[model samples]
Target: MSLPLAPGLAGTRILLGISAGIAAYKSAHLARLLKKSGFEVRVVMTEGAQAFITPLTLQALTGEPVRTSLLDPEAEAGMGHIELAKWADVILIAPATADLMARLAHGHADDLLTTLCLATEARCLMAPAMNQAMWRHPATLANADRLVELGWILLGPDAGDQACGDVGLGRMLEPETILAQLLDELEPARDEALRVMPVHRDLVGRRVVITAGPTREALDPVRYLSNHSSGKMGYALAAACAERGASVTLVSGPVTLSTPPGVERIEVISAAEMLTAVESRMPCDLFIGCAAVADYRAAAISEHKLKKTEDASGLTLELVRNPDIVATIAARPDRPFTVGFAAETQALETHAGSKLERKRLDLVVANDVSREGVGFGGDDNAATLLWRERERTRRHTLPRQPKTALANAIVDHIADRMR
Candidate 1:
């Protein structure tokens, strides 16, 4: 979301630092996203980062001249690093390489970026990206711990497939995820601080059950059908609820996201498994069905992998309807306040309203997934929340925003309704 409407971050200055790594390419997008969010962004690049991505690219994206050399006589005539350092409200190093992290931890100021880091009093944040092995190394771990102890915030070294054809932790978070997290960490204006108050424990005695991600429909032991659900929204909701002191149980489908702190995560694969898991966590105060459960699954499980026949031109498999997880829970006589999500490509309101009534849901969050930059596998989302109040249906519209922000707003609404 753009920060223009946010009092504290409206004109926030961000010093975007890029270090050497394949992930440096993502820094370009990071710069753009920050700029789009109304943050004044300036970029400083390590010499090695220029090898992977050029300063010109970032300069163009941020609309600010990029700084490369620490001792460029023309720029340093005014102690450019110090000036840039003083200009920033926050210093964020994306693709903070292992070498850079080590240097930062040990007080090295060898380059413009590192030098600015040393000269800046602004809050320091890093998004570390390196080979999985390097990230897990004893020295790297020590440096990371030390950086945190020194008041530096570590964004993520997300786990997943890497450029080296090996998969594990060490990937930098997506630009949108980084932006969302940065906003969440920053304190809003005092008058607006209560909007996302840290000390609030409004859900202290509540129990929340949330389902997230895309359920896989097994076609065989090796193949399955699933959607492009990253489980980000659901996980965000779980985190928000947990932060508010709610006992949150997250019934999640296969997704790579890290479990949020204080949340109980139960992993499952198929829609049936998710349904069973949710049912087992029943009798909760609130139930949020956010999973993209497949509408159909293989009607019959094959004993072995199906092989293509030389004589046959094509093949067909029978499919059957899968159980409607949210509807089933809502139908229960002991149902809690049930919330459902309707992710539609078209006629969003019509579909969502139908689910709210047909499934007997307390609320239905209608999402238009066809929109770019928000929905499905992305880090941002927009929705129309529909619910029945008194004798008529009421709706609230939430503009496109970081899933974390959206989740917080959704929870706040739910809390208000519950009260």
Candidate 2:
């Protein structure tokens, strides 16, 4: 399953403020990186910073005109500062010099950047940069603490060689590091917002049952057979469902992942146990079979660990077919809107459609596991959705994306189809 193309930073707005400091030079690269990563970047330079780097440099890098004043009548006629403040999703102050930190900490709105910081409801993050002595100054430390107490997220003034011959803390983090941290802070908020969107919130108050990971088929007392399913996909589905306010029961096989928030998790080791768990939590509004269940198990159990014999003859064990959990549930008179997963290496749609019909599933998420980032242990996936529309089978291709993103899309689709 090859996911569709995505602009990683589309619709995300970032207001970048540069304060006076030699490290202000780094803001250029940061602006460019933020843009490249899908953020709408707008740069603001403090008066003192213009001496270190030209506004033209940042403006050119960010593709937006630089804003550097608190009282430009032409702009102020429309209360442009207020508009700029309201437009930001996050305000980042890189190269936040000691003086600038103090101004913001004391709630000074003397400049356009500082004024916007005061006006905007967006989250504020500062990356302090200065000489070690100045950085270690008690007043500076107090200002930093004050800013932190005011709900400002302060990124590192990392320890390293300073521009001033001396070496210690007070170096600005690399542009890449700042971008990664920025995304980490904002992505959760974005996901949370998406969770409540009217279009994506259809699952609210609905009951969902999701099975994930691989079941172990016992071969002997100390041996068992299992696939490479890491259970990440199923876990993501559970989390996505919970985010949409669904009452979710995640029947998970042996995996190291934590239970998703707002989800009830049932841990099981074998196919029989998994089926038992699913049956007990039944009468769900939706059932998603994402687990990679072993098709067969040993016909008989061995009380002791099987050992190699002196003759070295290969051991032979009889096997029996395991219960088809998803099909059994779908066969019920009061079955939920049943869904299943098909991880295939070849003929993906063909095999997936077959499974959808064979199991009588309302929807099937078919993944070409052979594609990179689609299946197994990875944090990302790409999938094709197969659902019966009257007598025809409809397919939708979802591009490769983080598992959480894919899960949300899938859940939204399920909701739409149900409606």
Candidate 3:
């Protein structure tokens, strides 16, 4: 399914400046992505940026002429640099080199890109990309701090493998991430509302193990049974938990989601595999079985591939119950604060209450997947969080919002209780 876009990103004017770095190649893809996402994208290249990537290539991708020089008299006649700078709502510098960053900090405008950066009232954002050593250098560090102090937004210099074969910090964040940050910049109110939520490092030193996504029950070698779970909620939970200083281990089912930073990820395909994984990460402070593990699996396996019968004979196969991962964990003598998710189509509160009692769960987050944009494969969700402790039952309603925000709220609730 196509992921939803940033609010108000469509038709927003964005000025993208490319700098000298191997990561410049990524900016080509970034330009194409922004344009496709409905941003009015324009490209500016420094002389050094031109060396790494051609102007024509960026021009073709942006569907507009690329600007490169500080002094092109013909273009200067119209003061094109100033015009372009004024046209932008936000100026994004990707693959922003240490040199460029230093120049920006010191108020240098010797180049067209830097000149435009000064000429505009538009918001300025930078994504630093360079060698680990360069990124760590005291000079670069000071420059970065200065930029931040001057109200210039600096995005990630993510740690990963670099082109120079050295490993450490200094990889530019992917285009998708930069785009998300871009949205946050464009819509500060969305971010501000999140900041008011009650969450902190209250889970520090806690160990959190969460299961996410849909478990696949194999019917044949090539086919399986799974749900419409995108694993987004669980992944968001993993991220939120980590952000709260918890040591998070994510036992994830088959899903195309990236591991949250600083979280350990365990990939499993089937329900049985999921149970084993969750059990192995034992004695954690919390165990959240957010995975949509299949209730049953094929009772027998065929040695070879199953094929359709041309004679129209129907085939039947036996099925068996899969292990109850969350219940089993909750029953452990050293059980952590167990949390489970009930993505119900009907009677959400009733089913959630039953699950909480049946599994002896500390909490159950119940959401009506039947409601559009609330659960399953969407970006947002709403839920009724039911709790049971010492025979007392309580529940709180989580308002409809982004899964990230909802996950934060869940984490906040758990953290507040634990504290």
Candidate 4:
């Protein structure tokens, strides 16, 4: 199905930057899609990119001469790079390789594509493509983080099969998906209030507190209990709130994700530590308890690692219930508007609704973690928002999508309810 075009995208100018990767083949289809969608399309090809897809093919699709050189005498006569930079409303680089990301992050204007990226005042979007290992490497992660810090948007390095027979994240998102993300950024939410608002930063002057990641409950000095929460959803929500001008404080548990720009992050490990950290940032305009806190902890922690005796078949330890962070917050006399997340294995809606009533939460975001790609450590999510509204309960289901997009949707709902 064709996607709906946003009102703000009328007469939009797009400069498509293709980097070298096996995913470069997808760029041809991307260029055609952009042109067919009524965007004024232009193409820029890296030298290595020419080996995968010829400039002539892209030129044919875009109806514009593909530019590949930083030193083209004819084009440079008019300072072509500067002109191209000014003409675009957005620069979209598909198959943005790890090397290209590193160069861009470090301000390397050594090639035509990089040079134009440096010169452009336009918003930049990158869809990274590489091997799974490379994508997960610390260096690449740091580079990607730095680029985001510099106001660049990353679409996806979606998880799945790759050209090299490796299966994991590092596949560039499909062209349709990338275009949808771009459209979302360019336009307001399809709501009357957001459409008429002068500034899209709806959370301005609001204080938001978020909890994230899996809290570790120590059983011994060397052992702990935790979950597979990667903190992606919570972190995405934090970024969305910050983008809307909220003063956000993220009370995070153990996770390797970087702190979103414009957010204050407090690091903790155990559930108790997380509770203390969250309580200290209380009385905010909104509070989202997104953390996957452990339900139990060792009643008596062993200072030393427990060793299994050969004669004993198994070892047993006493356990105690951990404090329920979200429930406690909702029970507060002066509680802020509270939201909780329910990661369920069955009866998604039923459990979510129960959480809403039982915990006294203003809203509960429910997701089935049993699904393949939409929960737990994955980058995408589909959720149902359950809440009580006067005489009836309301339920809104969000389809499977990148956590970034889903986060924005959740924030929009929250903002609407607040209004």
Best by lDDT: 4
Clashing pairs in 3: none
In angstroms, the error of model 4 at 26 is 39
lDDT of 3 by residue, 147-178 (tens): 77677876666656789998655778788778
- Relative to the unseen true structure, what is the C-alpha lDDT of residue 208 in candidate 3, on a scale of 0 to 100? 85
Q: How well does candidate 3 match the true structure in TM-score terms?
A: 0.57
Which candidate has the highest TM-score of all? 3
- Lowest-sum lDDT 10-residue window in model 2: 1-10
lDDT of 4: 0.86
Q: TM per model?
A: 0.55, 0.55, 0.57, 0.55
Model 1 clash pairs are none
Candidate 3: misplaced stretches above 4 Å? 1-199
Per residue, candidate 2 scores C-alpha lDDT tens digits across 256-375 of: 997664456788999999999999977878999999999999999898898887896788889999999999999999999999999999999999999999999999999989987669
Where does model 4 exceed 4 Å of error?
A: 1-199
Model 2 ranges with Cα > 4 A deviation = 1-199
**Backbone clash total, candidate 3:** 0
Q: How accurate is candidate 2 locally (lDDT)?
A: 0.84
lDDT, each prediction: 0.85, 0.84, 0.84, 0.86
As a TM-score, model 2 comes out at 0.55
